[model samples]
Target: MSSVRRIAREEWRLWLRSKVVVAAALIVAVLIAVTSILTANRIANEQAQRVEQQVAAEQTFFAQPDRHPHRMVHYGHYAFRPPPPLAVFEPGVDAVTGQSIFLEGHRQNTAMFADTKAAADLGGFAALTPASLYQLFLPLLLIVLGHALFLRERESGTLAVILAQGLPGTKLALGKAAALLAVIAMFMLPLIAVAAYSVTLGERMLAAFSLVGGYFVYLCAWGAIVLAASVLLTQRAVSLGVLIFVWLFAALIVPRFAINASSAAVDAPGKIESDLIMLAEQRKLGDGHNAADPAFMQLQAEVLEQYDVETIEELPINWRGVVAAYSEAELTDLLNSYAEERMRLEASQSRIFGLFGLLSPTIAVSSASRAIAGTDLATHHRFLRESEALRFGFVQALNEKHAAELDYAIDMNRNADEAARLRARVNASAWQVLDEFRFAPDGADERLGRAGGSLGILLAWLLAAGGIVLVAARRVRL
Candidate 1:
């Protein structure tokens, strides 16, 4: 162990003496700092903005003047998907999938105002965020600075000299790994500070720690791979080429391939296509706007029989309201069914991508980071589902008010005259019956559970790399 420490100190001395290596490290450190601060500020600003918008939306809904219940249904509401506390660390899919949804009767809207288009406006490399730096650039930096670790020593015949002095090969290997770990820690300082500050953003210590830990494991795995490559390869140039290729393949190629593979595996329908299908299906159910349509004649007959009345005019409740409520319930079910199918297909695609992690630790760490930060597809879907629930409940409450409160005489002639329309409107106070929309994210335990598979794969990669380094170290010779 003492020998290992001495060798590690010597390696550090070499790094400090190399001007190019030192300059590169400084550049990365500065990038980490800048990206962290900028991202933090952006997240804080968005969070505050979303909070204000959500409040305004709620207030506007409750402040509307008396209007027909169906009118209130069309008036609708909005649900803003708040940024998770740790979103500063990992934004995940929020950039592309959007952040706010418009909730109204009989229609389910996709999220709007995603940052993807704005990011493109800035430039493609605008994604040079802190998370991207960790996942892609840091390892490349390591390969550039340290790919010659063992190869240079072997080419200079230092291995024979060191062995001649009775120093074990394992110590040299472990020592080089220690030096690389120190470098990794140096690059991780900005991230570590961000993680600590993340605790203050929310009571999510488990998630924050898990996030940092995943990155740590990921970087260490790279370190181990670099060590093994340096020793196993015969020439410094060859080692550099192989390590660079590995980095590119693991970080870039594998992820893209996984995405393509997943898309191929699951032929999920596009949004417009899905909407067209749903609209066609809805047409088959008849025009909900017209209760007198032959398609709803059975519903009218059922309502009349249930109320023991000869006609809709003599029935107890307003016929339009009953039809409105029934049609909405059916339509909502249709929307939910489609939503469930879409979610299932997406989930399947995600699973297929996760399986590719076996080929690249980068994929594993990326998945785990998003999952633990509560910014993955699952979280986004949770927001959509909860928002839809709120929409349905509010719409149904309006339907109930339309049935129980409005006079049928006024409803049938609501458009007949301004006076009749005025008579048909219900008090705006009725909207107060609906509770405000508040998204409840999954618990920390659930997030950790979801990330368990990726974490396991990362651990496996680390162990395999470590094992290769250890076994190869034992056989090291001049």
Candidate 2:
């Protein structure tokens, strides 16, 4: 181990002395700093902005003047998803997914204000973040700097000299791999600092650690592959070319192919189709407001008997409000049924992509990072589901207010009588009692637990790749 450290130190010095390598390393370091700072600041600004928007939405909802309960329902609400605490470190799927949703009566809305869509609207590309810099680019940098590790030693005739000096080929290869790991640590420092800060703040610490672990294993895997290629191949240039091709195929091409294949494998229902189905299902519930409709009349009769009243006019409750509440309950069920089905299908697609991780460990690591950070499709679906729950609760609160506070006479005569219209307006304070939509992210432990299998695959790849390098190093020829 001491000899290995000495070898690593000597090789690192060689890297430092190479002007071209030094310059490349410096550029990569600068890029890391710039991306870390810019991404942190940008994500923080967006988080604060979303919080402000949420506050404004709540304030506006509760500040409305006296109005009919149904009017308030139509007035609607806005809900925004605050990016997860660790999301800036690994934004994952949030870039393309929408961030905000509008909640209203009789309808479900897709998340709007997506950064990807906004970028497209602006006629420019979406900016890449530090996550991509870490995941995609840094590995390529490793290939550039270290792909010729063993090959260069062989080419320069140092293998015989080192072996003749009593150093084994395995130790030489391990030493070079160690040197590369040391360099990789420099590229990883920014992420380490971020994760450390997250831990101190007690913000998704498990997920943060899991994300860091996954990346560590992923980079180690790349190091192993680079070293293996350098030793197994006959020439330095060919080694570099082979590693670059591997990086391109594994990191770039295969994931794209896997995504295309997964999309084909799953039948994810589109938003429009899901909405149409929900609407059709809701329409089957009949005219809830029209008490003369047989279905509603039956409901009205049941309610009248339940309340021990002979007519709705003497029922001491607004029949319209009762009908609205019942209708909303049924409509909400339909909404959930379709939403859940569509979400399940979409999740199936994501799962299919995950299975493709076997072909490209990059996919496995990427999925693990996103899943652990609570920024994947699953977390987004959690947000949407929770938002719907909040909508139901808030809307139901209003409906209950209508039942208790609204007069049947006023509701029945509002369109015909101005005085009745004025009387139909409920207290604005009613909105104040309802809670705003708040997204409850999955616990770090839960996310970490869920991401364990994918992380395991990354570790498995690292181990397997390292084993290959070890075997190759053992058989290196003079």
Candidate 3:
């Protein structure tokens, strides 16, 4: 144990004396700090702006003159997803998933204005969010620190001297691993600080802590893999090249391939297909234009019978309002069904990517990070589902008001003059009565549980790498 501690100390001293390692560590730390500050400020500003726009849009919608409830449903409402508090630590899929979604009767709109798909390839590479930085660059830095740890010692004939001093090979390997872990700690400090500060800003403290923990484990895994490769290869240059190849494959090639494979496997329906299918289904259910249509006429007859009125004129409730309510219900059902189908498809695609986590720990880390951030595909689907529910509730409430409050006598018969006047007006107060959309962030425990399986894959990889390192160390000659 004393010898191990002495070796760890010596390795640390050696790392500090190496200008390349010191400079690389400093650069990475600065980049992390800069990214944290920039992302925090940018996300805060964007969210504030979105809130203002939503309020203004709501006010404008309600300020208009009174109109039929059905008209308001077609007019639609917009809900902007609020950015999560820990977004600074891991932007995750925020850029890939659109922030604003339109909610309306008879249609389910996909969220729009995604930053990821909007940018050119160059911008994609240049964007410096936490996920991008860590996923693409951090492993390379780990490789730089780890590739020479043992290989260089062997190359310099120092291993024989150390072995002659009676140090066990496994202990030496552990000491070197400990030294690399220290460098990993340094690389992770800024992110940990960012996570700590996120708690004070009303972020989920436990989730933020878990994010930091996950990142630490991820970087340590990279270091371990690099160390194992260094021990396996006899030439320092060969070890460096092999480690770079490993980093490239794990970090870049594998993830891109997984995404492509998932995309190809499921073939997610494009927006056009979804829109056309929904339109066709809506028409099949009941187009308001054909009041004489069998479905509409049957609904009208049922509603009249329910009220025990022989004539539509004698009905206590406004018949038009009743028709609107029935139609809205049918529309909601169709849209919800279509939305669920799309969500299922997307989930299938994500599952394919999740399976790749076993092959590349980077995939596992990326998946875990996004899940914790609440900006992954699953969260986006949830937001869309909740938004649609809210839309249905408000639209249905307005439709019911049309049936209960409006006098059927005046509303049923339409003279050209009265029709124009009615078309031009509605109770603005009705709009004010509708609830605003709010996105609830998932609880820390829920997020941790969702990400737990992926973390298990990562841990499994680490243990496997550790085992390999053990075998390599035991086989080392002098």
Candidate 4:
């Protein structure tokens, strides 16, 4: 322990004497602080903006004057998925998946306002966020700092002097690693502070915990990898080159390959294909607008039979409204079928991507980060599902109200009689009876459960890397 402490102090003193290391460390600290502040503020602003927009959307939806209920269905409401607090650290697929979806009757509209789809005038690309620094830059800095930790001693023939002085290679390796750990801690201090602040948010507290815990292991693994390479390699240049190449391959290149492979192996329908398929299925089911269509005629007959009425006039409820309700229910079923298929495909892709976690620790860390932050594909899917449920319920309620409130005489004669048309217009107060769309985000327990596998993957990498480092340190030679 004394030797390890002495060597750690020795390594620290050397770094202090070097102006290059001091400047780089200072610059990295400043960058982390700046990025953390800016990203957190930006995410908070966007989240608040989405909440305001959602309220406005709801207000506009129900604020209509007396009109036909079907008009309200077509008017539609917008559902906005608010960003989670942990999004300040890792926004994940939020930038690409869009934030707002138009939930209307008959159509499952695509989400809009994706950052990637922005035109040049609309802010062409996403600015560098804090997550970018954590994923790409910090590891590179660690690599550059520790690439020659022990290799430099070997290069300078200090390894002979140190060994002759009776210092074990393992103790020397442990001390150099302690120095790297201190440097990594400096980089993480700002991020940890931001995460601590996030813990004040309800569900994100646990997410912030996972983010902090996962990254701790993740960055330490990198330090171990760097230390192992330095101690094992005889040449300083070779150690630096090999470590940099490994970093690039694991962090940058392998992830791209993993995504490509996952996409290819899992045959998922694209947005265009999914949309076209949904439309075709809806068309086959029936057109809700055409009352005289054969499909509608059958639906009318079924409702008449169900009500024990010989004719539309004898039915207690408006037959047109009944048909409208039935049509919506049928269409929603089709939409759900397609949605489930799409979600299943996505799950397959995620499963395949998990395979790459064994090959690259970055894959596991990225997955764990997004899952805990509630910004992963799973959360987006949950948003879509909740929005859909609300849309179907609201649309169905309107359709049912259209049937119950309007007299059959008014519907039958509305085309020719102005008085009947006036009678068919339901009161605007009807919209108030409907419930608002409220999406309750998953709780901490759910998020922790979802992120567990990815966390395990990171832990596995840490353990494997630690084991290899011990072995490498024991065998380290001049």
For lDDT, the strongest prediction is 1
How does each model score on TM-score?
0.97, 0.95, 0.93, 0.95
Could you tell me the lDDT of residue 212 within candidate 3?
86
- Candidate 2 residue 285 Cα shift, in angstroms, is 1.7
lDDT at position 311, candidate 4:
87
Instruction: Provide the global lDDT of candidate 4 against the true structure.
Output: 0.81
Q: Cα deviation in Å at residue 231, candidate 1?
A: 1.0
Local accuracy of candidate 1 as per-residue lDDT tens digits, 1-478: 4888888889999989999989998888888888889887777677777888888999999999999988989999999987887788787887878899998899999889744425543664545668888999899888977798888789999888987888888888998998998988887777778887777877388888888888999999999999999989889999998998999899999999999999999988855678888888887776667878788889998889999999899977888888888899988898889888988898899999999999999999999988988889999889988999989999999998988999788899988888887898899899896668766457889999999999999999989998898899889978
For candidate 2, lDDT tens digit of each residue in 18-91? 99899988888888788777667666667777878888999999999999998888898988888776776776
As a TM-score, model 3 comes out at 0.93
Give the winner by TM-score.
1
Q: Which 10 consecutive residues of model 4 have the lowest summed lDDT?
A: 116-125
Q: Give the per-residue lDDT of model 3 (tens digit) for 1-478.
A: 5877777789989878999988987888788778778777766666666677677767776776677666787788888787777776676666767888887766677788634323453465425787667776888888888898888789999999988888878888998898888877876777778787767667787899888888888887887898899888998889999988887888788999999999899988866688786786677887653445677888877877888888877888767677777887887787777778878988999989988988788999989988887767888788888888878877778777777777766664444576654753347787775677767568888888889988888888888888888899988874
Residue 59, candidate 3: Cα error in Å is 3.6
> Considering TM-score, which of the candidate structures 3 and 4 is the better prediction for this target?
4
Worst 10 residues of 3 by lDDT: 114-123
